[model samples]
Target: MSATVSPIREPLIEGGKSYHDITVDLVRSTEKAPTRLWWIAFLISVHVLLFGVFCILWTIWHGIGTWDLNRTIGWGWDITNFVWWIGIGHAGTLISAILLLFRQKWRTGVNRAAEAMTIFAVMCAGLFPVIHMGRVWMAFFIFPYPNTRGSLWPNFNSPLLWDVFAISTYLTVSLLFWYSGLVPDFATIRDRATGLRKRIYNFLSFGWTGSAKHWQRFEALSLVLAGLATPLVLSVHTIVSFDFATSVIPGWHTTIFPPYFVAGAVFSGFAMVLTLMLITRKVLKLEQYITIGHIESMNKIILVTGTIVGVAYLTELFISWYSGYIYEQFAFFNRALGPYYWSYFGMMFCNVVSPQLFWSRKIRRSLWWTFLMSIFINIGMWFERFVIIATTLARDYLPSSWSYYVPTWVEIGIFIGTLGLFFTLYLLFTRVAPVVAVAEVKAILKSAGDQYLAPNTEHHEEIMKQYKDAEDKGKVYGSDHAHSESH
Candidate 1:
């Protein structure tokens, strides 16, 4: 009888890619010189970064007056962008830590790039609060660290200080976890390179020897880091929500903010991951590794989180009305029907209505449609933060004191500058390393690869070469360890 195949199951790695094929294909982009397309993208990003730097310097020279902050609406695009960036960073840790714990094989395809996105996005997020302080030089006043100016201490009670602690800790853990995974992969590149390149990669890989002992330590360390990072995925965003939830402002002081913010973060995080990967898969000829199956898995998450965010929106409205507090009711009412009604509606359409389209399998799996939807979701998430900040502050208690918050060209440029900085960092990351996790991807190849799952005549012959001796002698092939040897 012939071996039967399960129709319900699909290959995680497509194109019947082999173990050898994985190394050559994944490492090819990094080995080759930067393409003309990469150059074009890099140049555009650098130009944007330069313009943003000029704007930041202009703000510093001109003072906070260069921004559009006023008596009524003191917060503007700065804080909005800060929260937005932090939300974008959440998916990296979640995918790397939570999925690892649960043993989800699909996460292997995208986790490396997602982790890098987290670091870059957090770096972008950190830039805003420092600049928002106006007296950028005295930003140290917000920190609890002792300085030459005596034992000056920041208020322990301040939610903003809590933000400084939570975010910094989150970044530290994420960096360590990300780099640990890169070590083995770096050794792979080191083995393949010559002269200066080999030396550099050797240093980066920390002299990895592919020994059983080395693999054991790597696996143990990954488990420990995964355990540490799992809590951070929940804690970081929950702490961020505290920035608004702890506030006295009508729209800001709600119990739902914690869960609401967390869900919205995951929602936006997956969308961003999708956005970057869609472009990357096409650009680097990685459609086989980052396949349609991977896209569908992530899209399913976007759908779930998007629905949670929509419910949170409704809950906010219902609570404001149910509380029978006029100011509270008006706070949300103004968001829906007041001066910033456009953003409120746009947020709803993008975060709620757009994601509903993914209920259909074909639509969620369509790369072009998914790309377009991911962009829309990111924009909507940005609008959600804007609504929470600008709309709530713009139409506060006294009608006469109410003023509109507008971002000056300086503020706008700095925001764009952060975007440029984020992309610039990511592009450099793609150039230097395998954006996909080569080691982890190879680990799952036999279990999840299409050719391995259902071997044809060609696959059967290759399998015989790889396993004939082991099968006869009942011996293992190198202790179930990945054969990391270079041909």
Candidate 2:
């Protein structure tokens, strides 16, 4: 006797959508005129971004002295916001490149938006270091080039300079990977377009004809880029951590900073992704494409990364105590019990304690709760940066030199401006580009759609045997009727 096997479970794409339906749904947002809601959000983002630009201009005109930087705290909100934006960018690469390499198909629903977020977040991150240079005009000095001013070159030993190379390389590679994925989708749009739109998409598509060779190259390139990006995602943050770890500062210098920073980055990055995707799904009506399953999967990641970050926090405290170093121990204690202790506790609550709610299946599946938690995670991560940078610097080794650092209005404006800039770009991207990867989503149609079937060999054989037995019974009945009629 044979037991029956169950078929594969639920579909990734719900509502029984076809390949054409997927294309239509994704491209519809791009083709339609901007909604009132879109315009409202865009204007708000622009307003904030412009304000940030004004603040940046003010800083450049008056010099870096316009802000709160002083002898005791050379890096304050500028570096804090820089690290925050950089960490937020990491989730995009992790979702798009790392998950792709791991063969995680669920990534297809979120990768396009996540990749865009990464690019925009990096753009925001790059601005801080550049503007932090008082003479923004002389920012090119950070790059190594033969110049008339002797043989002056950027110091290769400095992790700051390493950031120059690492960030630039990461940005370039990420752009290529993102655009490569877009080409096929661009071609889809091009084929459906006419006149000027047609011409624009045609150029964007690079004459893609959907040929077997084009797809072959596309897949090969995606795999290659994914491989390159997997190590890159790790290396970029690791190098960023190096900027602090290599320093002589007590709290900053630690062997655990690399993994600690990487985990924190992933945590913050996923939070931002959830925040954006939740809104996108609701506004753009993409529930069928980005289902509850996708949201739940991301929540699990947030839970994992958040826990890892919480452990790192505890470990740092433990290591400081165990080392019995005066400065190190004082720094950790200062972070918790000092003047900025509120920020530390806030970070702990948001990053460490909040994500634990995901352990409940109900909360993970609830849209509103997920969104609220994502916001909390973002806040916690920001406070984490504040605790790391400001608190550590506010109380230095010497009591005489210790001073509190507060962000001036200029610094505040610029940080707020970067937020505006990020949203502005993202809002525009949603309007013009496919928020969902059309081709990638299409590729998964067979496995994710309603028409999917189980290919269990045992079940197939059992069904075949039942059909043969029925046929034999019918033949026997027919033979009996013929004999009875003849008699």
lDDT of 1 by residue, 136-207 (tens): 998878877777777868889988898998899988999999999999899999999999999999999999
Residue pairs whose backbone atoms clash in candidate 1:
none
The window of 10 residues in a row where model 2 has the poorest summed lDDT is: 1-10
lDDT of each: 0.91, 0.91
Model 2: per-residue Cα lDDT over 1-487, one tens digit each? 1123234444567777877899999999989999999999999999999999999999999999988788988888998899999999999999999999888878999999999999999999999989997888999999899998897998999999999999999889989999999998889989999999999999999999999988998899999999999899899889999989999999999999999999999999999999999999999999988989899999999999999999999999999999999899999999999999999999999999999999998999999999999999999999999899889998998899989877889999999999999999999999878999999998877766644533443456788778678767775566567678998
The TM-score values for the models, in the order shown, are 0.91, 0.92
